[model samples]
Target: AALRELAAKAPDAIARLKGIGLSGQMHGATLLDEAGAVLRPCLLWNDTRSHDQAARLDELPAFRALSGNIVFPGFTAPKVLWVAEHEPEIFARTAKVLLPKDYLSYWLTGRMVSDMSDSAGTAWLDVGKRAWSPELLQHSGMRDDQMPELLEGTGLVGPLRGDLAAELGLPDGVQVVAGGGDNAASACGAPAISPACRARCILSAPISCTALNG
Candidate 1:
């Protein structure tokens, strides 16, 4: 919403600029069903008002060793902290702080969930074990309660939420599978999935095979 507003407000200025590419940042909080529908403002990924918290977390060796990711201001933890510290009013009202994928899934399924791949992108997960890292969450001044339930990559996420399904004219009970990160899903398709094939690039043959089988 904010991104669209910014783009519309300065299409020529923003679109004409070259050199470095620019993409709008959206607030993670605004993605939730309750907040999104209520017109809650978002906190963009690049909004670095949480630099102090991010810097503090960077000093914790356990964070890097466990998560295998640096505490960058763009990640959710920092953005979350920024909201908590600066916008207590909004923070108090937040139901959950979700990542981009999780946010979209919420609107689709009318359920909120975090899969391993998306969770790994946040600095709060232990990628090796594919679970949330307590230390990371604690250091970020967030609680595990703030995160959605973690599910495997192949798990059945849930059926589409009623209102959303109705809006899309999808039948009730339609399955909503847990989708992977786009690259990972492409990798799992066809020749890439086989050990004998080594194309070194994403191939569509496997995707076609899966689509046909389904």
Candidate 2:
């Protein structure tokens, strides 16, 4: 496949690309169907040509308050806007827009979804409810129709689509758990789950030791 070919050539080409100031790579997988056909080329997160859209969103204090994060051109909504504006042809062809992990889940299960944590990063979700935020979408010049359905982080999105499973040499009915964003997963991997414990360890390691003893 094209990706395999790219990967094979990347090591040699990456350094040269870096030298030319085109060093960035997006960390997402391209989804494929049961027939091993590419659904679409995966959009890389570092594609930041949506600076205008990002700037407009960033100007709104509501964006930061609602999303609990600053608007960055690298995030999904801006990227979506970029596609809509610059690549209307591709945008028109898109059946679904998904984050990296969700795209993989789609390939595995033939389901399209927007996981809560990833949605939170998109500037398209109501952070408190963890659902699509219609107001944010409207403000961003996008419609709710353009967004994927939402799913809780621990919820079952679907099972692996049978033919895809067989083709991948995986068993049928592999459960596709709605996954969280990279940050949320990384937090779950930490030594302590509690905020106080983590804060103590991070702020004062000696204090964490004392607290552990006492």
Candidate 3:
């Protein structure tokens, strides 16, 4: 609805657009059933209902070693685990899983692709290699088939769906670019990633901070 409203406001700009970039909250678990139906409401980045699951995953050395981050309740992996434990029927029916923005990409392009920056927060990607980790997926009771194809933020995710493009007043050839998570996208926009930078703040649904070092 918001997207439709935005597009309605600028039909000229929408028609001129060559590509659309997506950026949304990181670590959100958007589960999909075998038929591509949403299983339930997305577990957002700030949801902390998976604290116990996060703690259990955090204790596993492989998680920290491979993902290069502590397993937080706010991450997608633990949230999925929480769903598996609490909503067994939904977990059993889940055929695909995606972060919020990536899910949008799938809806737009009919392709399941995700950017490294967003995948990193899911605790399922091997941060060093910038790819999905089989071991981590196994640990989380997920499979590679359920994950989206990996892509760099700059990579193209193909053209928008023909129907959607028509509805949104966008051209048929307008491609969708794989984009980073909210905070990572913000960092890209801000000039705070320099080595000398000590700290940076982000104000959003949940305020956050980033620290840097030379």
Candidate 4:
């Protein structure tokens, strides 16, 4: 309906769209069932119910080795572990997991994918390698099949699907790029990534600071 309204107001809007770059809550988790339906309400980045699980995960040297960061209740990995322990049925039904922005991308492009930047906060990624960590997955009680394919932030994951494109009045081949998480997206175009940048980041208050390279 909103699409129709947008199309009514500017029929060329979608056609004019060159690409979609998304930035969203870094740790929110969306679990998808085998049929591609959402298994449950997403456990958002701010949800703190997973603290106990996160504390337990912090004990694993393997986890610290892979992720190079401390586990937090706000991270996706422990939240998933929380779900697995408290809601086994949902975990059993999950076929793929996505971060918040990836969930929107899945709806738009029908692809299950995530960018390295967004994936980093999941504590399921090998941050140094910028890829998923199988050891972390196993420790989290997740299988390889339950993770989305990882992509670089600027890599093209797919083009708009035919039906969705038609419905949205978008051109057939509008490219969809893998987007970073909220902080990473903000960090991408800054003029510099010096100690000054990091300093200002601390002053920014409440913003998640991540590593940035030129």
Candidate 5:
């Protein structure tokens, strides 16, 4: 509805647009079945039902070292473990896992892909390598096939679906960029370019603190 409203308000601008960039809350797990149907309600970043799982994962030094972040209950990996334990059926049927923004990107572009900053919070990425960690995925009982293809936030994610473009009254082939997580995107909006500079977003619930690196 919000997108439609925006499109309606500025048809000319929409037509003139070259590409669409997405930014959404990080860590939320959006699982999809083989047919691309949502398997369950997305477990959001603030959800803490996976505390036990997080604690267990945190005890494993490799998780913290590889992810370069604490194994928080709100992160996607713990949530996946929680789902596997509490909702095995859904876990068994899950063919793909995506962060919130990537899920939206899939809807728009028909491609299963994710970006670095968002995937970083999943506790399944090698932070330094900027890629998925096979060991971490093994620990989480997730397979590489279930993960989305990764790209940098600036990478191209092909074009929007033809039907969606027509429905929104926009030109066909509006490219979708592999955008970042909310905090990372917010950091890009400010003039925080060095390690000494920090960007904070208090407006968002569960406010984010981002460290800008040169």
Candidate 6:
């Protein structure tokens, strides 16, 4: 139904869709196994069952240095750890971890990939350097192989799957693009305005306040 709506709104939807830009809920963990099957319902960014794990990770100097951010109940790393400790069987079988938008893109394109900006919020990437933090992954009880290949927000994600295009009643090979998290995506359009003022602000997703130069 949602797919139909997506098609309905865009005339010649698939062909007209030059590229897809998604702004997913940051920190939501979507675990998939080797077969590409979802292991369980995603623990969304708002879920707080991992609060204890987040706090424990916050005190780790190594994590702080690598990620340049503190672990929070809403971040992906502790959510992964929480699953590992409590849902051991599922965690054991998990072969790929995706952010929310990446999971949607996967279902659309059958490709497992992520974007650097979105990955930054996971507490598993060096935000300053824009790459996965191996040491942090190790400490979080996650394997390096389980992560999706990261891309920049502007990177190409190739064509849309033929079947999906056809199903949506349009041309094949519509291009896709890697996208960023809510804050990062929004930041792309946020005007600097004036040095003393700000054009935009994101309440969550790092709670950052960037003071732009006029």
Highest TM-score: give the candidate number: 5
lDDT of 4 by residue, 21-133 (tens): 76788999899888999999999999999999999998999778889889989999999999999999999888889999999888888998999888889989988887788
Q: Note the Cα lDDT for every prediction shown.
A: 0.62, 0.62, 0.89, 0.84, 0.89, 0.82
1 against 5, candidate with superior TM-score = 5
**RMSD of candidates 1 onward, in order:** 11.7, 10.5, 3.6, 3.9, 3.9, 3.3
lDDT accuracy of residue 37 in candidate 1: 53
Model 6, residue 38: displacement in angstroms? 0.2
Q: Model 4: which ten-residue window has the lowest total lDDT?
A: 202-211
Better of 1 and 2 by TM-score: 2
For candidate 6, the lDDT comes to 0.82
Please give each candidate's TM-score: 0.66, 0.70, 0.89, 0.86, 0.90, 0.87
Q: Write the per-residue lDDT of candidate 6 for residues 115-173, one digit (tens) a residue.
A: 98789889999877777878889878887788988888888877888988778665666
Give a tens-digit lDDT track for model 3, residues 12-108.
8766788889999899999998888899999998899999999999999999999999999999999999999999999999999999999999999
* Model 2 local distance difference test score: 0.62
Q: Of the pair 1 and 6, which is ahead by TM-score?
A: 6
Evaluate model 3: give its lDDT: 0.89
Task: Report clash pairs, candidate 1.
Answer: 27-43, 109-161, 190-206
Cα lDDT tens digits for candidate 2, 26-92: 2232333334445567656666778797898889887887777778887777776666677776555
Residue 41 alpha-carbon offset, candidate 1, angstroms: 3.1
What TM-score would you give candidate 2 relative to the actual structure?
A: 0.70
For candidate 3, the 10 contiguous residues with the lowest summed lDDT are 198-207
